[model samples]
Target: MSPRVRGEEQPGFFEVLGTWLPRQPWFRAPRGRLSLTRVGGLRLPTPAGDSDSRVFLELHIFEVAHQDGPVRISVPVALRSRPSAIAGKSAFIGKLTSPEHGELWVYDGAGDRAFLAAWIEMSRREQGSRNGRSRGRAHAGFAFGSPWTLELRRTGADAPKEGVTRSIVRREHADSQGEHDRDEIVMDLLRRPAGEQDELLESLITLSEANCEVIPKVLGTIDGAWKQKDDADDAGYWVSGILGVIREAGISGPDGTSIMRRALQAGDDLSDSARAAGRAVGTFHADLAGSFGAHPQTQEQLRIMTANVQSTLTQQWEQVRSEFDDDEAADLNEVIDLMRMQLRDADEPLMLQQIHGDLGAEHLHRTAGDAWVIREPEGLMSHALGLRDVVTVLISAADAVMSVAAETPEILRAAAEQEAAEAEQEGQSDAPAEPVNFGQWYEEFTQAFLSGYRESDADSAGVDSVFFRAAMLTEALDLFRRWRGQWVFRPSMLLQVDN
Candidate 1:
């Protein structure tokens, strides 16, 4: 049905829209139909030289549900004078048949490369402002952030557009071509009109593939990518390649053992096995920080983010503080302080470098050879606090190990294998299996790994012992968090000590 064109409101040209906005993938609404707050006549922006007034119509859409609930995105629509004859095939935005206006089309101008390109190119010049700004050499690194963040009335943050169409980065010495090609696609997905769910789903799959690739090659190995196939498409990528032989030994994915776990599991607690694992993470942090420091962000940015982080921690702490006895609260407080102090101390003013931003046990990878690895820096904050990465990863990993350390090696291994298999069955994946206690089996594993990390010319060791203790504490606590219900913390740590 064609959308209705009002007879009295005739303005040389007419554009038609429908109530079908809520179903779009790009629509950030949890559920709802679009209500036209204002539908204005199109204002042409072009080289028409004041001759042709064929302006594109604009629709400012407010977020709403199917006549109910709330949506996360602000909908603004600028539709062409008439649905382009070619609108039906557009990938990001598409055509809609309207009863009032005929077979018209809708396009998210922001998603259109023509519309997004200029904004991105322009933003390339604005590197952030900050002090103690890393004076050493650094790569321009990545420039990215959450494009379409949800805001509620309580926070008073304005409802944002559904998504960012694209982000641009200009390096220390480079042209303004966007650094990450995949990001534009991601931003396009962000800025897409909510109507196209299929594009969103496809974009998500591509994003997952990118995360899988970021794993360090030592952990991922040449075969790692191949082993990481549970989905049919991923399986195809692996099998079609001649290197598919890697998948035969093990699987990969969330369902399977990750390279980090594999690397950690391969060792017995021979001397420095644990420390070797630390090196993997530390080295990753170092590289990430170095790359980021070269392109510093202003302190104001960190100040804003740290406030958000503090609010989250304070809320969590208050709940736990009330529940805990003195000793437990103290312990919790101590760990929490380790995390909080970084933000608090930075108040005086500090340098801004990139961090893994989202680090955890899952992101830490291991290989079959007892090679501890850090990976999947998903929240790879180019402008972030470096310590946050270390703190969060350690805390998260500790939470994991604390719970699982008590189980017998065999039981744990069997469970891991089963979980890996189940993940594969459900299209989840783990990593290639090596000796669960690789430290004992291979005497040189720890030494060799540390040697490689220490010898690397790319980075140097600058982490303070305080972070090491925090790392250890977090590692230990992870065990506690996991084992808290099944077994007492002491029993597990005392018994099935992780090598």
Candidate 2:
């Protein structure tokens, strides 16, 4: 049966959503009265002989008006006869009194198991079935001849288990995370629907097709076209590209702590795990290159990169000159000059390939079996220097180390003061100990990471030190601009590019 829209038949559907939509963390809009117009939607069918047959699963697309422009937001809703105990309070939307269905309880479908199952099933059907059709009402002057079309693809070989529980994991990022059945599958619902250039889905599909084992296994993808609010017919004129994705969840440690957090707690013992992560990343890069094909660095690309680096350095210098004294300014200038020289002298052959645009410790996790699993490959660039990813990871590692090391001086000072007081009371004198070299740890970590990277990929003969140093300098300047005093001298110390 074709999906139907019962919003008109059900009373208070829009009113209920207006009150609930703004409060959601996924909803990207100003917290005020929003002019929400229903643009398009789909009501997915539930499984046969389901426990909760009365539940209605729906995915609604609404165009919200703002000062800047109109933004389309997708809200997957589950309407039940009564409030669900499993969904909890966080997933609950406002209750509505439907004249057709009586008193109904609404919940965010992303968190509901029924909705997820239906979504996965629909995606799976698209993989095997040829007669699957997306049908909706038609009107005059429609650009497309057919009704809305859903193009869902299942990438993973294994099917999700039945009766799996669902839970939503909220992160700082724009997308929404939904975990199924205790780390079985992690679904990321892409909140902002990009029309055609869906980098995340495209990257996943490419990697999955290539059988990249380092990344999380992609299970399925949901993408399609939907009718616009002003469209004459139900034939979709607007593309809702890559709505959501399902992938296997990364295996965490025995204590359930993330690899990044573990590194922060024990920086000295980070060599092995750091090396494993680096090797995994190297393998990931290799797979990406193999899938998408790599190319030699071009002169035009180099020129553009150099210009961007120069612009960023100049801007950062202008922003931070007033914050430092003459000596500090001289040191900064020296570093900037050194970076410029490195960029100019970078003549070595480098390979350009699709890169993980944002690779950090947070995206890496070590399993209980000591294998490293990479996550969140959403920030992907089709063409970029692979060293960019390496530089990003190194910068992230530096920040993690410095954040803890920043408090060491004050802690040591307090300890020394306490010791001196005790000694004075006892009529004894003690010499101060040598200061700890925190930078040495970061240096060791960097070497280990690079070593692992080299060990993993033979194609990566060696990293161009000049370009690496230059990238680090540019990253440092950018960090300093954002963090100001907190990051003023730390980057220089941790980077040690001069050495």
Return the lDDT, model 1, position 38.
29
lDDT of 1 at 336: 69
CA shift at 272, candidate 2, in angstroms? Answer: 0.6
Deviation from native of the Cα of residue 374 in model 2, angstroms: 3.8
Candidate 2 structure quality by residue, lDDT tens digits, 209-282: 66677776665666644556443454555555656665555632221124444444433356786677778889
Cα deviation at 34, candidate 2, in Å, is 5.2
Per-candidate TM-scores read: 0.37, 0.68
Question: In model 1, which runs have C-alpha deviations exceeding 4 angstroms?
Answer: 1-18, 24-35, 38-103, 109-358, 361-388, 394-435, 438-467, 484-499
How many clashes in each structure?
59, 0
Which one is best on TM-score? 2
The number of residue pairs in model 2 that clash at the backbone is: 0
lDDT of 1 by residue, 1-499 (tens): 2343332233321123333444454554443334432211112122222121332423232323344443323332334445433223332244444345443335554433222322222222222113221111111222233221111001011112334322221222322332232222112213222332333223223333333223322110001011223344753321111100000001122311233344344433433544455566555545554433434436776477567666665664564354445775676687667667865665444345555676665655444444554534323566544555545654554444433334346656786777678778887566635445422322243344335445432233223323333443444444434454332222112123333
